[model samples]
Target: MARPDKVAAVDEIAEKFRGSSASVVTEYRGLTMSQLTTLRRSLGEGASYRIAKNTLVKRAAENAGLDGLEELLVGPTAITFITGEPVDAAKALRDFAKANQALVIKGGFMDGRTLTVAEVNQLADLESREVLLSKLAGAMKGTMAKAAGLFAAPASQVARLAQALADKRAEEGGAAPAGADADATDATEAPASADASEAPASAES
Candidate 1:
């Protein structure tokens, strides 16, 4: 490649490295163009799979401030630059590799660390971002429902107690006050007893 073209290529790869959340380098030695096309389609628009020279990839990694990926860029190299959910792309690549024995998984980089082939496979096994988020939302909903019930129970008990107290007070208030009628009856009877005692004394005299 010419010097300017090489510079542009290095810059492009570096840009991809900087822009991506993760990247997986693979050896596509025996895979045909048709299979490559299908594999690219399966990865969707969230990733770009490109075949680049190892020297250029190394330079790009350095330019992008990434290190320790020198060994993964060996053989007929094609890198998958993933910007979206890493698990989904990893799954697609894993499945494709399983079907096509010609494609070899040559490790990867993600989340500020290098990944082994086994690690990449483990990544493929993880649940997608959507699934995990859905589970989180469901858990939150259940928690909120429990919290609402907890708050509502005390409020309902307080309301019932207030109503019962109000009813008792109303019943007490509607009748005469507790001791008024009893006191009046006692006073009237006392005067009769006094009159009876005076009559007996007058007759005796």
Candidate 2:
């Protein structure tokens, strides 16, 4: 290709690398065109599979301030630029590679960190974003429920105690202390009667 075309291609690749959340480099050595198309389709809208010249990709990587991909740039390199969820894209590449053994996972990069082939496989093993978020939501809901029960426990115990006291009072017939009050009045009257009798006896003496 001409110099200007090469420069443009490099610029385009660099921009893609810069925009992507992560990228996976693969060697599509014996894959057919139809198979490649199928791989691209399987990747869905989250990722794109493109075949580019190693020299151009290397220059692009450098331009994008990404390093350590130089080793992976060797061979028939096809890069998967993941702009969306990395787990989904990783899963796609992994599943595709499983079906088509011709597609070999070489290495990848995310957040300025390089990943080995094994690490890429590990990434694919993770659950999707939606699944993880759902799990988190379920856990948070359970925690809130437990907290509500905890906060209401003291109030519930107090109510139970009050009810128990009321029940005991009702079982004992709930009567007033009329007998005790009458006895107290009688005791006061007896003291006054004794005082009156003493006064009469003194007057007679």
Worst 10 residues of 1 by lDDT: 172-181
lDDT of 1: 0.94
Clashing pairs in 2: none
Deviation in angstroms for 40 in model 2?
A: 1.4
RMSD of each: 2.5, 4.6
Off by over 4 Å in 2: 161-205
Candidate 2 Cα lDDT to native: 0.94
Q: Could you tell me the lDDT of residue 41 within candidate 1?
A: 99
Q: Report residue 199 deviation for candidate 2 (angstroms).
A: 18
- Candidate 2's displacement at residue 29, Å, is 2.5
Candidate 1 residues lying further than 4 Å off, grouped into runs, are 177-180, 183-205
